[model samples]
Target: MKVSVVTLLQESNVENFNSGLEVLKKQTLGFDNMELIVIDQAESKSEEQIIELAQLAKKANVRVQHDNSLKVEELRGKYISFFDFNYSTSPHLYKNLCQEMDKHSVDFVSANLITSIREDRNLAGAEEVIGAGVHAMTGLKLINKESLLKMAGENKIELSDSFIELLNVNFYLRPFTFNYVNKQFYRNKFTFNESYVNNSISHIRYIAEHVDLSASKKSVSLMKVQLLKHLTFLLDKNMFTDNLSEEEQAAAYDVLRNFLGLVSKKEIQSNDLDGYTPLFNMVNKKLDEEATHYIKLLRSKRHWYEQTNKYKQYFEKNPYDLEESLSWKLTKPLRLFNKWSIEVKQWFYKVFLLTLAAIWKPLTFNRKIWLVGEREDQAEDNGYFFFKHCRENYPKEKVYYIISKDSPHLYKVKKLGNVIYHSSLKHQLYMLVADTYISAWTFDECSYPAPKEKFIKMFGKQLAKKFTICLQHGVIIHNISPYLHKDRYNQNLIISSSEYEKKIIQNTLGYSDQEVAVTGLARFDNLHELSVKKQILIMPTWRRHLFKINKSNFLKSDYYKA
Candidate 1:
């Protein structure tokens, strides 16, 4: 065969496979000289899907195989390309690119990919899709199968399992000819939320660390431009957002640090960064004049309720290390006074109100009471699911859901019996006496009327033995040990949907096997009886950088547009 078109498939993109198949079936270069290799990567391939895929393959006169059973050396094609399940290509795309590949004898060939095309711009000759593999859309590019395998052999990469990684790594491998077709033949057919900012930062670091200094001047300039452009994009679009967590802020700093170190060896022109200066003096033990002045200015502008975007312009060009200010030092006494005031009030609540509620301790002792909540103001998530299950199935059991009295969801939750107002007297009583407290959010968000630390401080050792369950809102697919760690959340039990997730909880969160259960989420039970819908449901997960933006800014974001 002259060409091998490999398609990546998973449960998420399986629906789009047939359309991609149609694009290939109508190829200007006939199927007699081409072979389609379908690699199914989905976890549990259904018999129906398998049969349907077989039928499609038979109709198209192509080959279909699971990723596990396929061998790279067995591939009959001379040149290899990829098929992005959600993208459509021109009928002659493969033929056109292959002709150029053959004529030029280039190792890689690509076209101008459309839809969210960031790397296509002229970035000082480096913009020809070299170290930006993560951003470069698949299916628009092709590589010589023999050369790819040869590179894999030299690099010790297993092409069958790590084909994608090999391809990404190949982008940085120098002395390989690359050809780019200016025609926009490949177009994305769908839009999805990308962890672009974080991914770009990672890719930039990778290229910066691995790029060859002995390469052409144009290549070195390209590397510099790529780094600067990616950093600038992130600074303008994400770094200035209102809702940056402390950890995320630190991560941003790390990226900046890496970029500074990478470019420090060479003299980068001021124009190369588009007038954005890198804060290279931040690592110095003593503050510089400019940094000191900036810190003082920021301190004077700081207020109790300062708007998030008020000092954005100051940070537009470069982010400085000004997290701590002189005002913070001066406010220590005032902060301690405020803390004392709050403690006194809490002491009063614990002494008087808690004493009053303690009278009903005997009543709660005889019965097992489960206090559940989601968002303080809403009845959703796994906590609500479990609460609903208990209320509906075991009417005699005591299960109380908490929602704020002023919340719009209060009326809806009230329809379900045994509901209590959030932070109310009754809520506090229940929190103190309940056998178990459960939430999809933090314990403070549901169980405690105030912060959990205050509750701990007020109750002391009395609340230590209380059982709390973390009915996680979603499946933990990535490492979030910082949030879920036992030292941070300190729940008795955590509900996990899969064994893989249970292991992550145990291994990363430092939970014992007994403490973490693979019981799955209670919400999954509700999913069993759901009516089938002839529609698509797209529930994109939240990104850390975009978490705290206001509605206006959110609506204007590229994430919202996508």
Candidate 2:
């Protein structure tokens, strides 16, 4: 009963707080020893409206006060608990927390926050008080004011910061036991706003100040990893998408720079970073100031194209080091093995396959031997549809679809005829004689038995005579020029589903007019007669954290579980 529930109120959440007052009136804890303090911060409300709201709170025996500062000492209750109008809580949360606090004699009792009932699969609570710094600050917690004041005094943190101060108290002050009440008393409904930019800065500062680099190395690294992931999300979701002002963008930049400065380069260079490696590496290399200026230009409506060109010029002047990239280092072994395998395959083809070329040469002489494939192992995507088209329409064209014999989708390809096993002698010979190579991915798919570079080098004139068509897996929306540019993948022709997509490919990917064809996706051919169903389909994009991870590790990822 000696619990004082404190909540901050503003004009935006006035109605929400009014509803919350109704819930407080129905609390199991009697109002005689309990008090609800609503600190009003909304400036638009008139004096009459304030009085009416105070009278309404008075009906529930709650006190409404207008204050610019928080005076923790003025609280009459032995414990102070922070609550928000954005969340829904049970009537017995206060009573249950107080009971646990009394029984365990703990300084604070942390309750579970089930944001989504479905996401609370791992209901096993925190095993250490350090975990309180994470879950406790965001969710429901009842703190003994005596212990809080003592901790704040010893740690030299003011109570005015509220949740941030409480977070510091949780981390810095030792022997402050936090008992976790294994019950879902709260459900989160808070949406992230620009305030998140400032709040994240505060959390980053707290970690930098409190987490010892040498003593808690693992904790420090793990915290940095988590913060970097958050910064990446904030960069993509809020900074780029939200119409933030220049000052807000600058603040977001500072948050990123502060994180980069906190963690070492080795740490930054080791993680996958969820497609944020280039941005992080660029900032880490002291190009932060220049990059910040150019990045701001990208957010501007009027100066986007002009500023983007300047940004690209700057990037070209200072390109990222591939040897220093995380992906490059991680794939070094695979790349080396691939190179060695290519050398062996080319040697065998030159020594053995050329001897049989006399007989195979007769079959492909002035003929249209079309070779088709999707991936090295699978037969799906645009390749399958286009191959199906070729087999049904051009029966005498000698069309063959390449697929690994071990593929699960091999049956799908075999159902249509002329299936060639990938990496076989016949597949390698087919690549050499084929007049046109069609693929769903890159041009490299056509040269699977040997490396694309090796094949081009071994038979430059022959490759020139032959043509490679890219039936792209999907529309080109993102700037993936580094992978598809003319300097990277040498496809004779690139198919596009739309003129806009073709323009993006031409302008961003450095392709010429003759190279890109405005052909809609082949999969759409089947959609003409397809019936609409009374169902919804949700297709989330791929998560970078799961990339290159083994099946076992991927199955255990938080992204997978979520």
Candidate 3:
């Protein structure tokens, strides 16, 4: 019964391991067959975090290795049990794992599939796919490490890139014991890549942080660590499909609807938990008529199609052009601000239309140039909103929504009436023109470009009487002008829907006490009021120029010397 413990060190879950360590120590003191190995990979010996592990080792007489990982080749002859920071299983997780040998010869034990808590034989032993746990708190017991080493060779504990598909299917039926102890600890954790896709309203915060709804290619591509992480929980095969017996259609319906409830964007139309579902699972379940219907509904708006086509067109242009243009090279702030600007313009365009009253407005002058922005997602926008609003609210006034040159409805929009159009984000004179410059959430306004002449014209003397209204879109105040800057966007008419945001502006951005207004956000206000009384909030802050520092620390930064 000799047992060896292996753990991935550098995780911040000291509390999680605290309880498990206590349990392991108790088990070790009573049983002479255990040897615990806690790898401390902390960069420096900060006693605050890891020194206690050494003390635990001393108290339990277990070996604790610092700053080194076990070589899989060297671990060959040992019976090993590995856990990440998340080892909150019942002690029986280990005790029951040892019971697998009684069933038959076993190679390894996995922490994915679990027995039914209901204890019904009909449901018991049924395989439950636990994709989220893959590579996360991966706990495995090797009945024969020598056999694994021979099988894996130098492959070690690292999962091969190709094998990720298997894990993606929830540790596909590998030869391991399934412990029915899976639980989701991270709240509001999404199962889908919400941060990867933009203009997708699945989750507002992630959409604000990760995806851009306007770009065709958006930000939805896969990350290596993300792709690697969700796999290890996979079994050797997908045995759960077998449970659909007699209810294949029903099972698919459940899975897809279950999935639909997961991946949908954050619109007020349907289930708003789109960011939490797995797109691959939706595809797997899409074989049925109802599932297909849901997927089509999931892709629902033209936004999805437009974005898809845009990405298709981009890649189609040269086939391999992205190797040079990807934004991963920039830090988070730059990448996010770039996304925020594009979407704010598109948001200004799309949301304005739904609220406008009239249908057409004449273009009084060619001077009114409409410049389409860089929202490649191609999500549809409503030039009509601005036009109709202008005509109905203030008739005889010329108004136009600038659209990208590649906009599909360029001709149709032109044919609508006297509306004018432009194709690039570089359009000027509009922000500099007329008595007042009004925008819902145009990026060209909120973000200060004062240092550059192009951006400065926005705030130039000609635009002095200009009243630029910020229709706060995304939540999170990081992209707004820096706090140190004396002036922020035309501060006279600043408005926001979030009270928290109003507070944030006053506290962080240093808005003049009288100039700011807490007018509700328009795009989501109706949705918030009518749907579930949920109004999205958007206050902001920039990226940590150095490391992960607390907001409190940031607030205290002006006060702290260090």
Candidate 4:
């Protein structure tokens, strides 16, 4: 079987590249069975320089690709091996790995790596075993191209070490065969680099996201132990102080903050490997003494709701006694007032909406209606999409937009001549004049009440004469509440994405097939038409109760980071 050896060359380190190429040429598997593919990732290299490198590879009977692209789409090999230019493999490594694989049906194999720290290669470091061949990167094994491609899907192979490790971890999590060889099959050149700290912490996040912490508890625990050891080693060697510049130190501090947040997870918190506790205690002691200023800074930036040792003790003893704690006791009156104000305001708004309905009953249904989203958010969702379409299609008809005073889109909304912009305070007047009322969220108080700013006194019953529509935010993933189907206030129309969603809305909102429209989400109409970029935006919702009770802890959480 043919084995493809792939190496990515990023820097202009010709000496290291030649060393790795020489080792590949000496593989015992023979040139006929093994093919080398070198990917040139050095963007600074010109066409002439790249051609020279390609010529050198060609002379060694190895294929060369000069593009920086990592999409290994058309690779020709039964098994693919990834290697680094700074690493050298044993001559018999592939031959032995193939022999071992034949004895057992395995998907991947890895061996211990001998690391040399000195330039002379005289002083050798201990052999490092990188987990059960799953977390292995430098000394990684050969796997079938089909299997690797199947797992990778459309995700491009990123140059980031953390991203590459995440891909490997994902592959290992699949129910596939994996093995570890005791022999050292590769030699890695160890060098001190400040960037390694960032890469290491990033890998920790990848492990947390992809690994099933419940099933692989031991693995995660060991990783945490190893990470702590690695950090201590870096600190002892003065890697953070001597090597990193001022800007680098600030960047490293940000990474450290993120790492601390990851370690605070429930699964990671429960595990404490042997020797880790002593190291942590020592570090804490050192930080308390030498890093007093840094500790003070951290405390200043921390949230008010974050519990301290004293607060924890108070919580354990007092439990339900809010008056027992100084902080809680001081805030109790304000909290009570806030609670009372919300109920009283909601009551007043309900009555006001009913009064508006009385005035609206005698007025004619104005074909020119208005639409707005929940709160002072942007005009990007279903409501905005539908509003834009209506204004463009029927220019003669009046389409009003009730924008929140604090909305960032206020300026943009004002520029649209076809659409009239009004503040939320004038919503009751618009409700009286408009024939239709459209919103992304539920308008009825029994379902989803309007925010304090957008409160229109009218309930569902009062707007019975108008064409009321609830252009829902998104498809429902969970079971819909039975209260929605009752439609106590009377929503005349409900929009759904598909027949499946329509059925769910029908069952939950008690709306028949005729009442629900399957016109697809209007917001997604021009999504494909817009220019896309190679960037990802993650929008995560916050827990309301958690923010209210433990705002400090919520601010420090990964959800807030996302």
Candidate 5:
């Protein structure tokens, strides 16, 4: 099997690059089965400097791509290995990793690494390790290219430097066997600096976002290890200086708050110190008074879960168990009732629409169209685009927009001339008379049965025809089965960006190729005309459970502060 040794060259240090390439050449033999892919990302390097580096790579028989745009589909390799420019590997590392993987029939294998950082001195062990905690991507490891690609997905072209560690953790969390070759195969010459604290904390926040505490035990263990590692690093005065900036200190506080908020009080109590009492003591002695105060607060604040009977009853029944609680069992009926109520309400609405369709006159071809979006509270997405297009191109076309009762964009949609804005509840008459229906989401709000209703709505008569056009909100990243519910699949035309997305929609939603239109998203038009600004826009989606508990204080969340 071929191995692609991928190295990201972020800095324009030709000397370092040459040295790293030379080390790779000297350490590993038989370049026939190996391909070196150098990703050059030094923006400051001129054309001449880039050409020089490319020439060096060409001499070494290595392929070079200028920039960090890595499309895994374009790469040719059975196994992909990552290396840092500052690190040197053992000659037999690749061979050893391959042997270990084959011996154990594992997905990937990583070996212990020797780093310049003093904290990592005791990290290397003689015994073979097999778990997610081995930090697979950090050191020299041969990963199954297919598995890594599937986990990372197509959109993740390149990972930010701060997030690489989190990527490794996410990869290891997958349900695959991982093995550690009980030997130091790589040496890291780079030393940890002041940014280490911030990076480590960012990683903790990443864990909080990605990891499901209720799902995987291995993930939980890894989270604990990462937390402890960050804490230990903060406590280590030898590594960390006392001159932390105000911003850094504030960031540390936010990280601690988020960390405490994510984990349970019992988990903290159970794993506190964990035989690292010396490190704990050092933290108390060396850490600043403000840092110590945050730590104290974290230790004292009761986890929200602890107050719930769902947690208390679980432990009361079995202290060491990781199963669902009696409280969850007791609330099952209530949960089912809520779900049943929503479905029943949807059914009643559909029935009511069908009843109205039976008596209502066929739609009149008057160039009138109705538009709606995913959320009732906004006039955005494809629906908004279609509305804008109609106003500019087809001014004679009578357009009506459906807005929720409390929609914030109500005034904005009403300001458009010759456009009628109707509350969602009072739009049934408009739906019956409208020539066509355009929407960014499913037509669940206006239940119009296809084939029958399609004939009535489009041809202005009882002739067989279709009317509704579905302008999907975004590109499909994962399986689209969840969103293809109710009347979504019954739409006459489903707008898609590319052939790949069309295929995904076809396969997932069981839509015929003819029914799906490969047109670009309407909102993305004239994107290049927009002026660039030096501002960050954060759009966070709401979670039901969190919102239900702390709806008022959501804006004050540590996540938002960070």
Candidate 6:
């Protein structure tokens, strides 16, 4: 069978490619008849780089071609595989994979081995947390061509649904059915094994099994209220508690839930909006019909205080003009419409026109919008919506991210079509360029930006009415102060995972009830139990004030009580 291998090549440096090519030559174990397609992963269009690739393919005795031919859909076939050049493969990796392909009916296939790197060490599939870029699927695999054409044509490079679930939780590979060559083979995360010996493995595994690859069976994660409904059922009904590993399933969430109860035991005192992002996210999550009634009352009073005393006083004489400056201050309601004055009437006319333009925004999807990526490495894995869901959901709009220079995704981000990368954008530049926007509480877990600046920039005095959504990423444990501090601006949507969090976010961020939802991260499904006998760990994270597990025996007196 002919295998089509598509890999991005990385040379330590192109003009000096001898050493890297030497490594590839020695990789093949002297095999033949394989077709190799190389896409230069470098940004430079240097002559020497192209030459080096051609020469290396010749020495390996494999057919080589440069691919810039068509879009992803235009490229298709059975038995196709991809990876960057830095990936290493064992002598029989692909051959064994080929033999295994002969054994099962599948769509696409990847390596049994995934590694997390920190410095020189390989953290072999330890917990295999989903988002780190350090993974290199074994460079060898035989894929089913029909599946390749199917997924590629649809522009889905990875799973169809549950992409967020994949990111937020740890997964394990399926055994035998997965056919691993050795124990503890790792997948991607920039981890260094540090002191682990050759055979040591994390007690947990990721992705214990592969579900149906067909699109019909995909798209299975739930909204927040739905997940909570299910979770409440599971815990209240004692459904999985009978299983031997049931303790592990509850280890991540239980401790956090209890710890919050413990912390609440203390007095409610005011402090400068400290590390409260997670706390607010949790409270925001609890903002349902029941929770909203009480929370809205508190938010109303806070709003009155801010408006009567804070916001009106603060931005009254500011250089920039807006209906209201964003702050933990009073809000200006759109309902106070006095359109009779010629000036007010003109602004109303402009607002009327902008609303019409918004109705047809789809035609201008190519216009760029901000996809607020977390700048910290730890939070980078928080499941970027642009790459999976956002881009997929709004396929027409161009997405841009302003991330820190050290972000691992800089190169990969460029590869994603219509995505622009920026860093340290000036306030002026941000006002001029950004359209719709999304943001999180910072790595420092403080407040989100008051979005009106974006509105004023995009729509002038008439805020662009951009559809902004602020969803929390992890198990939240801090309080509802800084993020909800009377100094932040309210957003269009203050998304959370629980009703309690919804209340906190609305009270803190000052967005109203219409602004929030508890849609669970589409990624949280990892915590769920599949229909089959799959022994996997879908461990979501917890904030410091939430919970910490033993990492070994999850239930050993430290799981929930701690």
TM-score of 5: 0.43
Candidates in order: C-alpha RMSD to true structure: 17.2, 16.4, 25.5, 20.0, 24.6, 27.4
- Candidate 6: regions farther than 4 A off: 10-24, 28-31, 44-50, 57-78, 114-141, 154-219, 222-562
Score every model by TM-score.
Answer: 0.43, 0.45, 0.31, 0.42, 0.43, 0.27
* Residue 165, model 2: Cα distance from true site in angstroms: 5.9
- Ordered by lDDT, highest first, the candidates read 2, 1, 5, 4, 3, 6
lDDT of 3 by residue, 1-562 (tens): 3566666454343445555565665552233456566666546434655767756577453667764534555552245665545444444555555555335445555443232122232212313322222233222433445544543456534432122222222222333433333331111111222111211112222222332223222112211112222211111112212212224334334433433343324321232223324433544455454333343354455468899999999888868654355554456678789899976875664334322311221232433333221122221222233333454565455444444456675564455444333422223434333333334444343222223354453344544555444444445455355732227444445556567767677777676657567766444423444555667856343455524442333444543433
lDDT of 5 at 561: 65
- In TM-score terms, candidate 4 sits at 0.42
3 or 4, greater by lDDT: 4
* Per-model CA lDDT versus the true structure: 0.66, 0.68, 0.41, 0.58, 0.59, 0.41
User: Where's the lowest-lDDT run of ten residues in candidate 2?
Assistant: 123-132
| lDDT: worst 10-residue window of model 3 | 231-240
lDDT tens digits, residues 475-499, model 5? Answer: 8745656466324447777888999
Candidate 6 worst ten-residue window by lDDT? 195-204
The best candidate by TM-score is 2
In candidate 3, stretches whose alpha carbon ends up further than 4 angstroms from where it belongs are: 28-32, 43-49, 56-61, 72-78, 112-143, 154-562
Candidate 4 accuracy as lDDT: 0.58
Q: For model 6, what is the error of residue 260's alpha carbon versus the real structure, in angstroms, after optimal superposition?
A: 19
Pick the winner on lDDT between candidates 1 and 3. 1
Where does model 2 exceed 4 Å of error?
A: 45-52, 56-61, 116-137, 154-173, 195-225, 238-240, 265-275, 285-562
Regions of candidate 4 where Cα sits further than 4 Å from its true position: 12-14, 43-52, 56-63, 71-73, 115-138, 154-156, 195-225, 264-562
Spell out the clash pairs found in candidate 1: none
